[model samples]
Target: MSGDLDLELDPHAVGERVQARLDEVERAGGPAARAAADDAVRELMLLHQVALTRLLHGLTALPGTAAALPGLAADELVGGLLALYDLHPVPLADRVAAALPRVAGKLGREVALLGVDADGVAHVALTASGCGGGCGGSGAAAAEALTRAVQQAAPEVVEVRVQERAAPAPLLQIGRRDAGVPA
Candidate 1:
């Protein structure tokens, strides 16, 4: 019991490791064995889904129970369950908007959501905060950071495009002499 209690695992990390193991088995076991394994995994996932659904129903029926939970933990648990059932109440756009702060932290700047296109492309604009001078390397790093954040937060997003804010155009003198002649 102590050994079991000592093992702590992140759900996402466990899923990734399980997937890699499945791929290995598939490679070694051929098509028939791989198909059998796939079926087993699918059945197990369904069982897990049913259990979660029942637990959620009970928790939600209990007044004030869910509200008593901490914000982040509740969000993570609900988000995972919703994603599993394809029933997330928040739209993809709003989800991306919520993820901007963490992405901004990684980029060392503020990020604004431009919107998601019909093709599942996420458009984000980076605000010039700590990013002074705006060198090419820094721009690339910012783009990569936003991409990583969006991908993790919203896996349904097929791509991420970082839009550079347009620079202010140089002011033009309207006076005839100033417009046509040098100072």
Candidate 2:
């Protein structure tokens, strides 16, 4: 099984090979072919693990090497990992919810949302709580401000709209609309 087949790292090519092998396995006489194919896949995964480990080790050993990689830039790599995987960093939704406590403390109430744009980017969408009225702004005005912020932060986000929920509940539904793709 270990020596039956070679594996390549190209994901698309690997997918094609798997499809072909599955077809062949389906047509094969019996247990022998299935066992061989299973062994081949296991070997391929082992090879991948070995190769990736070696690559990371080599990169880490080279002086200043990790610094030059695009996605490996210190801030992005650190921030991305922290935001996505770290336990200390609050969950994004929870962070948004926690902001509510502060707002609730101030306003003596909570807010709800009507609907947020379905097309908006998930990370940039409005959460359970929003920018407070500390700016002396109305809900519509705050929504517009948030829209402008989204536009500036991600110009690719072409449109933003929010629906305000009923009174005594400060809810806002934000929607993100993507810019049209060029024909």
Candidate 1, clashing residue pairs? none
Pick by TM-score: which candidate is best?
1
Off by over 4 Å in 1: 1-3, 6-8, 68-82, 87-92, 105-110, 116-121, 127-137, 151-159, 167-183
Q: List, residue by residue over 1-183, the lDDT tens digit for candidate 2.
A: 687554433433555888787768958846687787778877887776566557656876899865554344223333233332221123333433333334334433343322224453323223333435443256655455555443332333345554444334556888666678543
- Could you give candidate 1's per-residue lDDT for residues 46-139 as a string of tens digits? 8887886787668768997666433432355456556566445467788788888886776556679999998889999986553355532377
What are the runs in model 2 whose C-alpha is more than 4 Å off? Answer: 1-17, 68-183
What TM-score does prediction 1 earn? 0.65
Distance from true location, Cα of 19 in model 2, Å = 2.9
Clashes of each: 0, 14
